[model samples]
Target: MNTPHTAAPVARLAAATAAIAHQKRWFARMREEVAAGAPLALVNADAPQEILRAMGIPYVVNQWWASVVSAKRMGPAALDSVAARGYPDDSLQYDAIGLGSMDLPAADVPWGGLPRPDFVIAECGADATRKVFDLWAEHPGTEFFPFERSSATTAPDNWWEIVPREWERAYAEDRLDLMTSENWQLVDFLTERTGRSFDIDRLAEVMALVNEQAEWNRRTRDLLAATRPTPVSVNDSIPAVMIPQWHRGSVWGRDAARALFQEVEQAVRDSRAVCPGERVRLMWIGRGLWFDLGLYQRFQEKYGAVFVWSMYLAIAADGYARYGDDPMRALAARFTGFTDQLYTPPLSSQWYVKEARSHGVDAVVHLVADDVPGSAFTTEALEIAGIPVLEINADNADSRGGAAAALEAAIGDFLERRVLG
Candidate 1:
């Protein structure tokens, strides 16, 4: 008989486990609220959710929920639901999974599934994202709100340094103005629909909380970057940083970030190592493989190769944190071209190279999702920096194509031939 693998106690962090438990409880409460006729908002990952947070509206992030669906092994069935509605099942699986899950039977839904949201909000980015959220509006009692997606007219290499205090220079003024106006519009729309009052002072407080949260993440990221024989796994750090990220404007979110920083600090102080044999430190540059998190750990035992960096934790450290006297504009500055930092050329390519060097990574595995832009530039820049690159073309959410085996094989080959050699 074969035995299933279980993580050793030290390999898992209590902070990651607690975050998961808290999210489940939070979701259960959200479901109950919706059942009692409270309104719910479904916002995209790139949309400004702090507005919803400050207004006291209950909300769920579409991408976060999609991650949950994918992690539960329900991605194929959810995609089937989308196809049943005559939508393109193969496109934007990360954003579309939430819409598809709404059609699934209750028994099949993950985490008892998402409650039917009264409002769907997203930035009108890409050709398909608007269409996906539009489809969401077609359901009864659901309305869609969109913010204009603006392109980055200027690229700044040192965004992480300037964004916290001097955001106007990091992003164009016109882009910030438009998003700030739309944020007010969203506030009005929510107020009219839900009869909740908006307070600018309250928003300022929320923004401060979010910035504090980002600072803690920065500390954790810096600690991990400077540590050798990496202290924590990317798997643990992802949830530890990202679960609280979905609740960014709250006290709990700020504290969660602090807890993660403290936990990693303690681990470092104790000299805990994910791979004590630690020959290679690798970077994962894409959406997490939600269905196969174990992929992060697979090479550790055989090759002493550990995935020490992922964009989830790294972006949380460097991408968030906007400070300004005007709360609404600061919020706008935070989201306008936010995706550009990770997906636009020059900016995306530059940041990835910076992160690679800072983390001291020997190699990178860039999971190339079809929906993400400027991927080629990102891969090329890392190569120019003298980092060995392994490109895997795969959907981070869907597992339907039997691609996992091929992906694993490709990575193994890359490790043996390029990285290990």
Candidate 2:
């Protein structure tokens, strides 16, 4: 068995540290703003946050807050609270955790708990997503805004290449048209409710900044993909990329992306490796296991395995980045089929294969969540491309499944029998 190298404890990246600090400060400010009568919006991960940013409304992402609840070890209690309300706690836990967290006492909540938002926005994509937001809207002083999620009737194989420039051809025009109209409706809703005018030019600026940020992420991902012995861990890269992702369309977000790129570049130049004896490169596909991030690094000492790729960073590289003259339509195109690219058929499967080959992935540990679609196709595609896959069926946010121990054992078994063999 390989042993971890006796190096000084790996210092967390300054970019990641600073990003967390900034988020703490930003959250505090958001609380203060909401207290001062400024409206707060709680939006789904796929919702257009740029609209809120451009309109100057304070917003918190529902999925990010759920991760916080899960990471803080409050997920089980939160889910229990959901079940006590006669709702199915096992369903859509990732989307519903924030609502349940709202019921927790202030002392038990993470980061002093999320303040009740005036507006809750989400795309009604999944079966239970609308129901989750509906419960959120039942809270006092909160209203729910739902965007119509259209199915992908057509998606080309070269989606990554086309989505950046020729997006009109990449996604069905009808789908884009629908989301664009809904985005406008959201703009109108916010404008009417808060008296904050929607400025298309400001949204254009936000979109431009977002594209610039995506470009920086692409550079960083390419550098990490090419670097041997992986200079950064997925644990570090996830927060470093995703925290800034929730803040996308801002100058701060753009700068944070650049900072991460520079930090990674510096690490690569200095030859810093997350696992000096790394013998296996692993890709993690699905929502992060917020309850047990250490799972990502666990096999390193015994198996010389390190999780080098996650969809958080990979999607930020290829999934974002839209350039067009019409910012509204461009923004719609960016999100219209975004989830489909990650969760739909041949698109998701093809992209995972491409990503695995690009990163030289030795194996994959795909966390197959109940809510996500096309996971089997993704795993099959990777296996067909001569890569081994270990699928774990569990909720990423909820810990009720006792996943930590079982997951570790299963991954260990996979490393011994499948990957290392």
Candidate 1, 234-277: lDDT as tens digits = 88989988999999989999999999999989887777878777
After superposition, which runs of candidate 1 have C-alpha atoms over 4 Å from their true positions? 1-9
What's the lDDT of the predicted structure labeled candidate 2? Answer: 0.90
lDDT string for model 2 (86-131, tens) is: 9999888999899999889999998888998999999998879999
Each model's lDDT: 0.90, 0.90
Per-candidate TM vs. native? 0.97, 0.97
On the 0 to 100 scale, the lDDT of residue 266 in model 1 is 86
> Which clashing pairs does model 1 show?
none
C-alpha displacement of 221 in model 2, angstroms? Answer: 0.4
